[model samples]
Target: MSYLRFDKTLLTNLEESLTREVLRTNRSGAYHCSTIVDCNTRKYHGLLVIPVPELDDENHVLLSSLDETVIQHGAEFNLGLHKYHGDNFSPRGHKYIREFECEKVPTTLYRVGGVVLKKEKVFVHHENRILIRYTLVDAHSETILRLRPYLAFRSVRQYTHENAQASRHYDEVENGIKTCMYPGYPELYMQFSKENTFHFQPDWYRGIEYPKEQERGYDFNEDLYVPGYFEFNIKKGESVTFAGGISAIDTASLNDLFTYEVEKRIPRDSFKNCLINTAHQFLNKQGEESYILAGYPWFKCRARDMFISLPGLTLAIGEVEKFEVVMQTAVKAVYAFMNGETTDLKVYEMEHPDVLMWAVWTVQQYAKMVSREAAKEKYGQLLKDIMTYLADGKHPNLQVHDNGLVYANGREKAITWMNSTVNGRPVVARTGYIVEFNSLWYNALRFVADLFVEDGEFSFRLNQIADKTAVSFIDTFLNEYGYLLDFVDGNMMDWSVRPNMIFAAAFDYSPLDAKQKKGVVDIVTKELLTPKGIRSLSPKSGGYNPNYVGPQIQRDYAYHQGTAWPWLEGFYLEAYLRIYKRSAISFVERQMISYEDQMTCHCVGSIPELFDGNPPFQGRGAVSFAMNVAEILRTLNLLAKYDNQ
Candidate 1:
């Protein structure tokens, strides 16, 4: 039996089918997303969404969806699903869905009366393109397939309407048409594999409601433009493909191009293979450099996420060349920031100061895979430049204190990953010397100091600073509550039992002693550990909010309060293995293996962003989050490394 195939019993259930979503992405920053049954329920759900550099840097929805119809013996069967105003599902095409499977790609089979049809979708890598192939499986008579394209031509954040200002013209290309409805946007070229006629008719598809957007308390209704339709005569055992992209495509070799792309994909036959395939999709190349995209559906290349995910997403899989490219790209961003030059290094603007420290620690991880001498030869200057800028207190509201610990404050909201604001105020306003920040600071100082050991004076100065920071770390963050204090400003200490405390044991050079390390792990395991990950806040803590639901404000308030972030599992497992040593081999394997079942359950092999803190921890964030998947892959690598005694 296929591991990821869904029969009609599940696909026909509209409520169950709509809850599961599928995503396909290309290296050119384009993606196709929709429900398992080809029904769109979110504003972010689109067949072709890409970054329009001329208009803005964010993604714009060009082609929202394609409605397909099959006709046999003068009888028509609608195989498309849509939602309109007043919670109505028009055409109700999901009832014809016989099966849905996601192995190498997402494929759906539709059985209308006696005619069997199969549809396969794949996003072309390194290009802004989507290919959809339709094959007639078991048709007794000749059949015709009709495809209607629904164009949004607006930013994903906004809805379009039936306005007169919109353009309604098309230019003929290859075997199809090209159109750009708005100014300052790239035109899209759409083509079919066979000879076809495009009827010159235009109409408005109005009152289309997105249920996911409505739940988020945003305007969910929009109007789409349908530019006629394409009709093709399909026969049994014959296949036809539709190509959509920003530039004109060669229709003659379209099938060959699709075949080449499909052949390049890695196998996804097992749980581990599925993860490997998903991990390969996160890296996108532009010109001579490559960067890691934070997540799919709706995310950009963020600096903090890139650093955090680089080691696992690249190095752990023996992708040393790509790893170096990503590191070089990030370091260049820091260099540009220090020199006050215009840069494309768009990280989280209100980022925690620890992100820079994580970049340094990532270098240390890379050194283990390669050699320190080799790393120094390639990245020595960039690393030194970053440290010099940090020591000089160049960044906003961030400074190295006289006591040697880094102090990052004065921001209206928190700067770290927990920096979620509700109604213009940070929900968890932690402003001070955060525990994780100081731990990373101490490790970075020591690691960089070791790199300059041949230079005596520089090495001594760096080690001296790290030594002082170690003393301050114990005095300020270690507490009588059996765990580390979350953060401190002046004499005020925030003793919230959060997962941030685990980093002290997980870092390359933790200041905590053996007794202290065991104490930290014990407290975290008892209070914050769950099957999915560690909760952001302990249940006993006053600020703990178990559910992450509701509108923007409510979700923000609960984002870091008690939501369980699966990305933290990497650090938690690393710390546990550090304190427990080789005795943790069996335990680690069992715990990590338990998540294999989850691969088939949610998002089809990729992990999600977060889960509820309560029991039965239902996933509650983005469907296929890159950070969570990277951490899981890193944990598996760690287990293999430590279990081989």
Candidate 2:
């Protein structure tokens, strides 16, 4: 049996199946995502979504969906599903699905009368293309396959309607046609592996609703254009391939190309392999530079997320070369920011208060995973520069105090990762001496000191400052309740019980002693820990909101209040194992099992961004998150180390 397989009982149920999505990416900022039953439930769902760098930084949906109809003796059976206005689904293609499995690729089997058809979908790597192969498994009579292309040539963030500005003209290519809906966008080429006749019947399919967008309190209605349908005869035990891409290709090589791409896929046969495969999807290689996308469907290359996810996404998977390559691009951006120069790198928010600290920590992880000598040889100068910049108060938002701690001015903007805002004001304005920032600050100083131990003068200065920061960190954050406060600003101590304190215990050079670290861990285990992950805020706190649902504003309010973030669980588990040692291995293993069910939920074979903090924690936010996947992989790597010992 496949690791991720859904039978008829689940596939035919819209409520359960629609919640499960499948995502395929080409490593170059293009992706194909949709529901398991081939329904476009969200505006982000598309068969071919690629970034048009000429127009803007955002991704555009070129081909929204492809509707397939199997004709037997002139009787047509549409295998396409779409949600119309008023909770109505047209074509109802889900009913014909017998099985859906995603091991090598997304494969679905359908049964219609005397025909059994198998459909497999694959997204070509490093190319803006999607190939789907259709095979007639068994048929007693001749069959004709009709494919209708639904084009929504617009930004994924926006919807399109019927307009005269859209060119109705198309250019005929080899065994296909190429058309451009707008002037700036790239032309979409629809082609077939074998000879097929194209019929031009352009019409707008209006009022198609995206229920997921409507649930999030946004405009959900859209209009998709169907230019024409391609019909071809099929014989039993024969296969035909369809290609949708930004550029035209040789029709004769389509079959060979599909086979070559499928051969590169790593089968999702186990949980670990599934996560490894998911990790590869987040890597975006653009020419000489590489970046780790924060999340799927919407997020871009963010500095904080890139560093936080780098170690696990690459180093933990034994891809040291990739780790260094991505770091080469990121280090350049970091150097440009520190030197007061602008860079053309596509990475954003390079000046986040703790981004430099996180970058140092990521390097520290590389040193730990590979060797200190390797890390020092490659990133020694970069680490020295980052430390000098931070210690001298060179950062715009970060300030070094006399007490040897870093203070951030987050009141004016959402500087930290809890960056939700309303009306230009931060929701959680944690201004002074954030707990995690100080922890990371101390860790960075000590790590650099250890790496460059030969430099006696620099090492001594960093240790002296680290000692002072350690003394101040315990005095300021550790409260009477045996837990650390979230942040401290003068007399206004934000006493919200949060997962930020986990870093104080999880880091390699933690300030807190053994007993102190245990006190911090105990409170977190009692209050914020859940099956899904560590809650952003303790439920005992008055400001806690458990459900991340409702309208946009409401969801933003709860985004970091009590939403359980899977990424935080990595730190919590690491801290637990650090304090309890070998005795905690069984507990950590059980906690890892809690996430096994997630491999089949939300987005199959991957993890989501956040989950509801309450019972029956439903996943919320992005379908697949890089930080969540990376952290989980890191935790798995940690577990393996303990097992080997």
Candidate 3:
């Protein structure tokens, strides 16, 4: 009863296996992603996808996939699968799979004609590298293994075509060869632990159709270059290690390096441990500081996501130093933004209003995890400067009203997390007095007041501001139906039922009264609650789109309208526990079981970004989402605190 193992029956079932994906990442912002059966159904699917500094800032696909074939007495059996044009599968290697396990790392077993081989893959953290070990678990005699490397030297957003611009060449290094198809792109070094065979036959693999890309309404066909094959001979119980990296690896040290990397991993025996391990992958360090990646395969380090995810991904794991480092990095980035020192908009830019509020909330969480003195010692002046800047309306499209509520207004309505826009217009125009932003704003103000008790004048100012905001929060947002209005501006109240109101009751320093808290919880539980998570919008709301499907524009509209985000479960659970007290522990425990079960589906040991709001909420969006994983870990940490109490 291995919790994360899939037998041959499931592996051979193309429909089932292809939908499920496995992800491995290195903190260097590189990843390995493919279907459970080693088949790539999407252009983003690759054995090595890393950020190329010299190229565009986006990720690029270097090694699309590696096809391994077993040669037994001249009969060759390909243990790799690929889908070509016309919906046809070539080599059908999935049929030979014995089992797929993902407890420690992703391991696949293959049994072919009395020869049993097990393949294990691990992405080295802090480096752009992948180590794959192939062991002949059982065999009657020596067997030869041939590996063909498929190279797609293109951005992850674009499809590659057969062109003469690609240099079909290689340079020998250590125990293997290094090559770069495109000049200025990082050179790809591939090597085996033992030198056996290398043949340089360059060819093109054309008409490779990625169905997932087509489903997303994009060009689905690609052409990858195959740079010959490498042959290896192995006897029973002998293992050979293969290394693929952007830079030339120490070929003589591959065996030791692989062992060291695998041994350094903490055991993941439980779902909690699995999530903690996955959470660690979301952290990448540059220079001497650490940053949190929003999600895998696509998303980069986002201010909003990193702040929202900080508590769970770092402090919840008892990583106080790393949490401090992240906060320091964020503060430095903010200062850089203020000083106009950075043109790197993606990292330094702060557009979302709620993201700024979450930054203060993250400091409050860190204060709880460490100490007020420690937090203030590191971030006190920085926090004060940010508060002053925000209060003076230095941030774009945002200002504090004389009534004390934060107001953000812009023609571009994509200012908050519900920032899904179609064409040039926002799909959900929640421009003024957004629910979540105000709740967090109130919370942030209150937190600063409490944290800086010594600064009486500043604390008094924040308290007065918070008190004014509280009155407006209730008067403007609370509707007659007992549910909070989603947002309000000049008698135009967007009275949509959304999970954003939950934060009012979920936070420690909530402005909502007991009756208001209960009303908010009841409304959300009744409409937005699902086994997976809380939906962004209620189904009964006008313009509610229950499914997160279709092409880019369609998907964008559904993204925040009704798509269920699993990460919001943490806030919902917090509000539920706050409203119910100790009695809610059992309920929380029961609800958490579903998430643990979720680990067995979709991306094994990881979480997906969005799910359908309708019943039977299938996982949608990114295969491995960092925010979802962080939220799950955060909930488990909170659960532990409640259970202990």
Candidate 4:
């Protein structure tokens, strides 16, 4: 059996199968996502979702789904699933699924009476294209295959309805058809490897309900335009490839193209390989610039997420070139931001107060991975400029106070990563001397000081500033309980037991002493640690929510209150090992069991953004998060280092 195989028992059950989503992406910000049974449970799910730079920043779903039918002895089997009104299902195609596995690429086996067929999907790298190959494994007689294309030419965040403005016209390209649903959008070119017939009959499928959307309290109903179906014959043991893309391709090369793309995939053969595969999926390379997408389905290239995730996503996986390219673009954007100029790169939220701090940490990882000499040769000036920028109090929100710690004013906006808002206001208004920011600030200062140790005057100045910051950090955040406070503003100190204080113990240059770091770790392990990750808040805290459910507003409220974030576990484990040394290796290894088991749940072969803080700890939020995946990989790398030692 394959590593990620599911039998008919699981494949036939809609409750289990629909929750297991699969994602395939092209490195250029296009992806194909749906459930294992080829059902789109969310509006963001589609067969071909790509970015149209001219249209807007958000991704658009060009081809919503493709319904497949098998004909044998004049009997037709509709092997496609869709949720309709009143809790109804049309086609009910999941019943025919015999097995679903994703060893190399997502492959599904179907048994429809006397015929057995296999389907495999691959999203081509660096291109806006998806190739699906259908092979007839066994058949008693000749089989006919019919494929119907569903089009939803709108942004992924919005739904479309039956409108007269939609173009019903299509043009024939060699062995295929090209259609453009609206103006200012790229024409969708769908082609087949073998000769096939194109039947253009434009009609709308109305009242298609997305249950996931309804659960999130959004509009669930949508109208999809079906432009008829393509009919073709297939002999036993024969395979045919279908390609959906924005541009026309040579029809005869479809089979070779599909095989080539499949060959490029890193097989999902083990837990580590699964994570390595998912790590590559977050990379979005455009022309000379490359970026790390925050998450799949709906996220963009946010600056904080890119910097936080860049090293683990690239360096840990041994993709050093990718690390360099992504950082090159990001460094340019950072320099542009400091100079008060607009950047051509697509990275968002460059003005966030802590992004520069994380960027320094990302470079610190590079120094550890390769060498300090190499890092200084490449990013030395960037580090100096960042420290200089922060020290001079040039940032709009971040200021260097006389106490030598950076203070941020998040009262009016959500400046930090816990940035979920209710009504354009921060949910947790963490203002004035956040713990992690100062932890990173002290670390960055000391790291740059050591890198430039030959410069006597510069290093001396940085060490003086860092010494004051260290003293101020402990005086401001450390409490009588032995653990650090979340933040301090004036006389008010937020005593919420949050995972943000973990950084104080995790970073290399921390203000906390050995006993103090151990105290913080023990408190977190007692109240906030879960089998899955570290909870955002302790249950003992008031207004603590352990579940991430209900409507959008309710989910946002619970997002950071008590939700367990897997990314935080990386730092927690790092701090654990730092305190306990080799004795903590077994405990750290045990914590990884839950994440390994999660490889087969939820998004399958990937980790989600967060999970419920309570028992069972069901995964929530984005299906494939960059930070979550990167951190897990980073932990694995850390563990391997200890094992070698």
Q: Give the distance in Å from residue 55's predicted Cα in candidate 2 to where it truly belongs.
A: 0.7
Task: Tell me the tens digit of each residue's lDDT in model 3 across 426-527.
Answer: 888887888888899899888888888789999898999999999988888888999888888788888889998999999988789988899999999999
Query: Backbone clash tally for model 4?
Result: 0
The local lDDT score (0 to 100) that residue 613 gets in candidate 3 is 91
1-645, model 2: which lDDT tens digit per residue? 999999999999999999999999999999999999999989999999999999999999999999999999889999999999778999998899999999999999999999999999999999999999999999999999999999999999999999888888898888889999899998999999988999999999999999899889999999999989999999999999999998999989998999999999989999889999999999999888999999998999999999999999999889999999999999999999999898889899998999999999999999999999999999999999999899989999888898999999898899888998977888899889999999999999999998888999999989989989989998999989888988999998998998999999999999999998999899989999999999999999988998999888999999899999989989999999998888999999998888889888899999999999999999999999999999999999999999999
Model 3 scores worst on lDDT over the 10 consecutive residues at: 340-349
* lDDT tens digits by residue: candidate 4, 1-645: 799999999988889998999999998999999998899999999999999989988899999999999998889999999999988888898899999999899999999998899999999899999999999999999799999999999999999999999998899998889999999899999999999998877899999988888888889899999989999999999999999999999989999989998898888999999999999999998888889999998999999999989988989988889999999899999999999997679999999999999999999999999899999999999998998999989998899898889999998899888998999999899999999999999999899999999989888988999999989998999999988999899998999999999998999888889999999999999999999899999999987998999899999899999999999999999999999999998999999877988788889999998999998899998999999999989998999999999
Residue pairs with backbone atoms closer than 3 Å in model 2 (clashes)? none
**Backbone collision tally, model 2:** 0
For model 2, the run of ten residues with the poorest summed lDDT: 422-431
Any runs in candidate 3 off by more than 4 Å, and if so which? 343-349
Error of 2 at 295 (Å): 0.3
Q: Return the TM-score for candidate 3, rounded to 2 decimals.
A: 0.98
lDDT of each: 0.83, 0.93, 0.86, 0.93
lDDT-wise, the better of 3 and 4 is 4
Following a full C-alpha superposition, what root-mean-square deviation does model 1 have from the true structure?
Answer: 1.7
